[model samples]
Target: MTFYDRDQELDALRTSFESPECGFYVVYGRRRVGKTALLKEFCADRPHIYFLAAQEAEARQREKFIEKIAEHFDDRVPRIGGWDEAFDYLGEKLATEQLVLVIDEFPYLVAENDSLPSYLQSFIDEQLQNTDSMLVLCGSSISTMESDVLGHESPLYGRRTGQIDLQPFSFQQAREVIGYDIEDAIRSYAVTGGTPMYLTLFDYDLPLGENIRTQMLSPTAVLYNEPEFLLQSELRNPARYMSILEAVATGHTTPNEIAGATGIDSGPLSKYLQTLRRLRLIDRAVPVTASAKQSKRSRYRVADEFLRFWFRFVEPNRSSIEEAPKVVFDGTIEPTLPDHVAPTFEDVCEEVVWEKIRRGELAPYSEVGRWWYGEHEIDIVGLAPDDDRILLAECKWTSDPVGHSVASQLREKAPHVRWGPETREEEFALFSKSGFVDGLADDLTDDWSLIDLTEVDVCLS
Candidate 1:
């Protein structure tokens, strides 16, 4: 759909342009995360040359690159013999004219020429550093980009002035693009997972179930093969990764559980898990009260909503879906969808509430995340910015109103958080989809914050 966020990225690029020194920037993220969109927006009014590489022969790509730059300069460029000549022409031109040269899908070019990064490094140090050129390298292959382009051992590691590991849109940004009621917008984000390209495919006019059938469940739909494509493009062995993803989506969160479910040894599984984490596909989480460095109770969860949706619902029932899309959706997908989306709703609420704290609408906090201990759990937790106080919250995604019992439960569990001194202040918040129960709102004091779906939208605004 239309552009929604990235103001920070634009500001950074604008600062780079204003600097008298040459700029070398690196931008990378998973496919369809809006990296190219950000670059295009930043380069819209500048004197720029943009070249998008493909999986083609090196000679063809070189010719295409030359053609793009030549067109931008409005001058004919002679056939370039090698990378040196191409970079030399760019460096020489910047001596007089300020320009932005963006090379998208940079990993494709590196695949074709393994020495491309080194050639680029040599050019940056020997020629471009002293000039006024702004060079931006963009890519979607996380593994290659991190290991070959930004890693410590990389030839160009020290050359980049800045690096952006772009992430998916937050709930607020996704809501802006969906253009629906606050509740429906949250659901839309939960299913589409804030990928801009996928969000465009969903029709807001249709019911959620209908949209699911048309845009995702149908065999001919664009997203039908999305999960497979994402894994195949990034990993060499898609089947193994699929198994790992399926395991995580099905509640196999711990390392031992995942290994048992996938029948893979723990040694090899760790490598695969690391790759998945680096790709931003899954996340390792621990109790909010526990130290990230010292906690041995870590668990892995699917971090992307779309991937989780696919693995949890679609992948498990693929054969049934192919045989009868409507039947499978009605019986299996629809009935279980609420429970499936509940955790995502909690995540969205957490983000919105965090924004409030940042904007001074709520009590400021130093840290926030999910908290759990033994058999007790709290959906959201915010540590006081400068003291020993903590904020605890529970997010409910059901249609039923949150009653006094929910508040009472939170009060009971507040004592178990073990954050600081026993007398530490504990503030509570209750976020609900269907609003608070009768008399429940009246019973709560000013110390409690009650947020419904509508309040979430308003607070975000």
Candidate 2:
């Protein structure tokens, strides 16, 4: 596959690239999520210089940037020393012509020289602000970007014209990339979180479980050691980060639970959790109805599916990768992977169907989300945003057809809904990986219903 999704994002970036005068684009995301790739794709046909910054001293990185500029613009590499000199020269050289300049993993450069952003911002004010060059700053260190470059206190704050928080592929795109049903695609997405590089390993030809074993069990595989690579890159103490991730991944969502599980006190761990949440690796979510942003009952979830899979399966069992890697991987990780991903798989399905619903693909849904009464949670709830029509969908990963018993269970929970009886009427949809029960569709004829993307296609068509 030649990559998938991101069409809208690519179009947006391309439009920025061809901006009439000046433009600065900030693209940041968690590691291995394809920020660099997306930039390259966006700037493929344009006159651009793609400079990937590395972890070296400030002077050395500046020299590297100069050298790339020289190579791109001339035969001999430039002898520039400071980053300011390189930017100054580039600004001067491209003064008359439009060019795209991309600095990938820009946080590395910012880290090496604390004044780099100031220096660049000054140059932008003095030189490039009057030119047509499009400057693109890309980074995987979201926490660094937010704090150092985009933060209000930073010199570069408010300097960017457009910012792109590049995200992983969506479940629908994942299906298109390799081909799979909504349920299976969601299951895969729950594991890989729509990441293109990670999704590349999934074989459209094989079963998800088999693919996970083959692609993730091997020590040399991309995803096998993904967590370590990611943590080791952005963090000072990889061990502490690993402990924190494992605690969260193992179903300890509260600060107290994570701290207790990781052997870190809640007080100190709060800062680290905040950092992780800011970086978008983990999320602190409250029930949607809650008024408070952060409450005592708030839960933490690995917002990135790849990270969740890594923490749940890889991080906790690093020793397995060390000794008899496959034995430990297939034996322990594979066995627990399915149950761990079931709920997420359901959520992904809901998301894909929801998107379709929004585009008039799945009929007119007034609202969509997990509706609950006290403790009973509906897997999928679609409301007629305008009317009293409500859709209560139960997504089952099981092979059997959804039975009538589930309908009764839903009815019991329906009364708890604050909606008056006249305001809400229930519709049924049983999303099953193995297909709905015989007569199930016929029985739901009186109400709105759909299978996978069936309603999606009808509405869209």
Candidate 3:
């Protein structure tokens, strides 16, 4: 698939390359997030040597690394005794000529030779720092990358000239990649999230449901077992983490609720949750009005849209899906897809609000997130504490057109959000899937906005 975004990342890399001194850059992210792709794109026009490491013996990896260097330099490479010798060889070449040496999956090399980071550190301090060449260390293992390379105690600390923590695409970028209508794009994003690999699997010629059946529900498809495969590869124990994720995906958001649902004791649950959060698979959300550190009402949510969809629909009905994929999707998935897409729709609406803020259509806000207290809940809230102003919004995904009652309910819930003073300014917005009633337009003012699905798409575009 074609690369859709990463203009900022490309610009950062270009700036580093244009520098006069040597460059040591670290790039890391989760699997299938396009780290390798981005690097390949950046190196397409530059003189570079790219080596992909694997989970093999240190000697074998070193041999392969030398072979890649020989191919790039167009010379017969000498045999190296150790990683230090390997870096020494590269350092000699880099001292005279400029080249980009990228070691993809650097964690795999560290797994075999634990002192690789120390050798590289010595190489940088002793040789590469004086040259005009560049070295890029890329990895998919977030934990190893952090603890071994980017951590304070690591020998390679303070040596990197730049770093890129690459992330998945946003809703708008994903929509552009899928080339679907607004509603179908929302559903596709709910299934594929923003992962480029998954988005590429979706054939634009097919409808969303057909794509789900052929590309997701089929037992042989890549996405069918992706969540399980990722968990097993990343965690030592996948079962416990899987249970916690399932609980969160199924609406058991609070710690107590998750503990009760997963049958795990509360004592050990925090560790598991923290691990999941570090992996970027789950997020902990608190009320917009409360401090995250002090909020007791924090709720855990599955961060990846695809994982949430899989745990909610695929994991539970695997047996039935194997028997009849079409029936399962038509009967089970299709009927409840709207409900499944509602939360993601709210997320898209929030993105629209952020766009409005960026374009100066709305006032700048310090923090923007969902706000909830007791029985009152607001779908989207933007708090501008300095200006003594608040933006409250209600997002409705139902088929019926939103009426004055929805706006009235949002107004009623506004006072419960104890953010600013009683005399502070308040702005309201209502996002609807089926548009709004004609009479509701009379409520529009300088402080009030009614946004429909079309407007949401346009604002984001």
Candidate 4:
């Protein structure tokens, strides 16, 4: 449960705190992504007042805020009539000393009193501009945070000196959190999806299957109802959004295909998809070589690993799970887990490629993603539009070693990717789970590279 990353974010906050002028910072991300944890870590050494807001009356919220200020500063609680008065009390303290006032879950306060932002704006403009104190507004509601506080039309716009859109951990960081081997780490990443809270829930002492059974499959488990809770909390109508997500997780990627699968009409499907995209639940993928704006062959996919796994395995088999959790995992989940982990393995391989680029082992590329056209598909493609160079890779998650035929097939599909000049430079890479055939190395040249699972671990590390 130890904090693993966010060095850059902590550094940014430290710099702002050490600055001479007052600092106004906004931090927001989806729930359980560690926004609060990061803020607490940053405030551990600083003189700060941290107040967590809840869904309550405005008066109750203000009373709690006053109590926190009083406790932090060891001063008597003041009689505040409104937010303006509350700021006046804090402003008097800021004039004498520096303080970091963080209101965690700022959206809840905004929900109760919509004019709170205006009061904070006035406080910043009129009182705290010259002080060395800081104010951090943190929230988990992405929509409310972006539209109400960070939006252009909001009264608090143009006031923030800095912002942190905290994100989930990368595959490497997730692996570090769970302390699993490369293969098991890949499987765990597929289930946890880089969410720090979920990763911390995993008992590293237990096996992966046991963890999945206890932490995810059981009806009493925390994660069993997690996806449902998140959807209900964030969206007004969770049923329709659940249906769309279920369709995408079960292989209905295109708009028409999802509409056919979910029985939601195509006209309104775009709106639902857009909302899901905004929530970071689903992603729209196009060919790596194609323009995202103009690409006709776009595909929708469940962006969250846990949600995709839940929809694919958990949601569809709730009855079976109720009957017997162990039976469901062994009979249904165990046999097909490799196939489920394959896509994540491809993603890890792509991350390895980027890591290589960072280490100067590979040249920089403009974009990297899967490439598909008609019947041809490439697992990983790196396009460097500036130098007319393309890196095409094939990732195999099978048990057997990849052979020359796989490389040959990748070569055959490379021409179908209409990128760069006909005489452009090309490179081929084959990423495998069980390494490559001994004979496959003989066919390698300066342009050909063979990467195995161990090499992937090393590259990413």
Candidate 5:
């Protein structure tokens, strides 16, 4: 597949490569997120040696690493036995030529040899940094990479000159990859959620329903075990994490609600939730107006859209799919798929608004997120404390044209958000999937902005 986004990331790598000094770069993210693809693209035209470690014993890994280096440097170099000899040869070879040595899946190597980071740190300090070679240590294990490679207490803490914590693609990038219209693109994104690997598996020419049935719901499909495989790879106890994720996916956002749903005690649940948050699998959200430290009304949500859809729809409906695929699609998935995409649509709209703010097309809001109080809720809120300004927005995913009532309701709820003692000036923005009703624009004040699906497409473009 052709590379999509990552222009900024590629630039980062290029800058490091062109520098006068050696560079030790760290690249890490969840599995199947295109980490290897990015590194290959970066190393395509350069003199580079890429070693992808496997889940094997330490001795086997060392042999493979030596073989890769020996092949790169040719038979002129002596056969190295271990990392110490390998780094010694690498430092000597780097002095003669500019090279990039990418150790993909570095955590796998660390799992077998716990002292690999210490060896790399010494090599980098003594020899690698003295030359123009760039050492890129990449991994998919979020916890291990963060703690052992980037954490403060790790042996290689201060050795890294640059790092990139690559995330899944955004809706815009995913849309470009899917090459579909606004409606079908939204549906695809609701399921794939910006993951390039998942998006590439779907056939865009076919009906979205059929694509979902084959690519996701089928028991024999490749993606059937994707979420489980990812969880097992990154998590210590996949069952406990799966339960917590299922709880969040089923609308159990609060701690007490998740506890009730999963039957796990609050103490251990907190630890699991923190670990999941650190892995970028789930997020803890508070109201836009509430302080993070002081708010007791925080809610947990699955950060990965695909995982959310899997836990909510696929995993729960396995028996139904196994019995009859068509029946499951027509009876369960087709009917409730929109409900699954509703929250995701809101997220997409919020991202568009943030993009506008980044381009100076919107107000200078300090914070942007969803807000709610008791029974009332707002889809998007942007706060600017210094300027005493607030932006209240509503995102509607329905096909029906949104009328003035929705904007009126947003206006009604703008005052309920308590930012400070003094009243703040308010602005309104409305994002609708099917555009707005007739004459809806005439009522718009100077402070209000109306953005429909077409506008979002253009913003993404």
Candidate 6:
């Protein structure tokens, strides 16, 4: 069975539910990222009412809500009409103890009635204020839901005492959810992207390659067309979005580069970029020292691992994937996926470094990021904020060990980063796929740290 990875989100909601005064909570996320699951799991043992908002007219939704609300009440109320009529009676129905009323996909209800939010806000401020009830508003369309319900100027604004901007599972959290080792979990994250629903389709017992072939690559697979499904819900022109996503997936970073590769002009592309950024599927990054002048060096990339994988492999070769499943799935996409994801290994290294820091293996650093001047880029740089000292890093994904030359090359580029503070204890750290270089352990004396990703005595348990 698939597991949950949101204990903190759960605990925080429960804590809010314990409030003596009335509490309103807003939970929003992208579809299939487990917003409903997190709330349902939290409300499982509690006395709560769950109502799904459909695209039907307001009268129909009111009837369904009334039906759900009746189950939680001591006496059944047959006919229910209007938001004010339903919530006004909720105060008197459960006056003794706290209860939860979850309106799933709350955005639909508000969309059906422009006055719905003001009506609910007025009810909470007036009638519901005297009750022992928790109002749980949950939705999947994040930006719309938040603006309509959770934003500062919203009718439900400042009403929510507790909120969860529920996120997709991180790569580390995926390890627990799927019961995979660090390396294998990274592969899962790269493909399924920590979405609970998608990861549930992944078979942990199968080899990673087999799992990808069976669940992700085949024509009959659920995720084979998952991107298309999600895009249909989120975009006006999925064809254009797919084109833009493909450019990013195939390593087009800047706005100029994406437009050039797709042959789509930048003016039309900016609107699409806004939508993707709002959905959090992609991100725009600047130099760590981001400024307000709208720098031309800004870059864009697909931020989700699964989407990245889909755009890079599945979308590009959809015809080949559909026609020759085994050949393309196993012989093509499988072999090339790792090379596509090598840089994300730097992401794995970041997590590993943080774990080691928490365990006192590596000293803490304020910032860790890639650094470059013009074209040449360094894999990882950790800086001590106080002293402005930097730890230069080299990551090797091959069997070869990182050696003195890597440290030497980084030092050569160090003058370009050109720190304004005194360089303190120039520490060299190497992350190796197989092991460290010979005698480098002896060469380190005591200042350097060498980490081998393959063989570490640290127990994950």
Put down candidate 6 lDDT per residue, 1-461, tens digits, no spaces: 44467989988888878878778888898888998888889898898888889988888888877777676665676665677787666655657667888889887887788788898888888866777678888988777787888778888788778788888876666666665665666666678887888888887888888888888778888898888998887776789888898899889998999999988888888988988989887888654433325756678889888889989988878898778867887677767877766766767677766677678877777777666658766677777767656766767766467787776676676666644465564566677766867887786646667777553324232
Q: Write the per-residue lDDT of candidate 2 for residues 1-461, one digit (tens) a residue.
A: 47566888888887876777688888998777778778878778888889999888888788778777777777477677676777788877777678889999898988888888898898778887888888888998887888787899999999998898877766655666655655566667777777788888788789887777667766677788777777778778878777888888889888888988988987889988887877677887643333246545577888778888878877667677667666775688656766776767566557656766666655677456665445767777766745666767776666566666765676666665555356576676665556555765565555645454343323222
lDDT of each: 0.88, 0.73, 0.91, 0.91, 0.89, 0.77
- Kindly list the per-residue Cα lDDT of model 3 for residues 1-461, writing each as its tens digit: 58778889988988898899889999999999999999999998999999999989999999998878777778798989888888888887787689888999999999997899999999999999898888999999999999999999899999999999999888977777887888788889999999899999999888888889988899999999999999987988899999999999989999999999999999899999999999999999999889999999999999989999999999989999999988889899989988889999999988998999999989998889998988889999999989999999989989999998888888889888887899889999999999999878876677898888898888877
lDDT of 3 at 194: 92
User: Can you give the TM-score per candidate against the true fold?
Assistant: 0.96, 0.87, 0.98, 0.98, 0.97, 0.93
TM-score pick, better of 2 and 5: 5
Q: Pairs clashing in candidate 3? A: none
Off by more than 4 A, model 4: none
Order the candidate numbers by TM-score, best to worst.
3, 4, 5, 1, 6, 2
lDDT, model 2: 0.73
Q: For every model in order, what is the number of clashing pairs?
A: 0, 6, 0, 0, 0, 0
Off by over 4 Å in 6: 289-294, 424-426, 454-461
Pull out the clashing pairs in model 6: none
Better lDDT candidate (5, 6): 5
lDDT of 2 at 48: 83
**Candidate 3: residue 135 lDDT (0-100):** 92
**Considering lDDT, which of the candidate structures 2 and 5 is the better prediction for this target?**
5
Model 3 error, position 447 (Å): 1.2
Q: CA RMSD for every model?
A: 1.6, 3.3, 1.0, 1.1, 1.4, 2.3
What tens-digit string does per-residue lDDT give for candidate 1 at 410-444? Answer: 99999888888877888889999999887887898
> Which residue segments of model 1 deviate by more than 4 Å?
none
Error of 3 at 433 (Å): 1.1
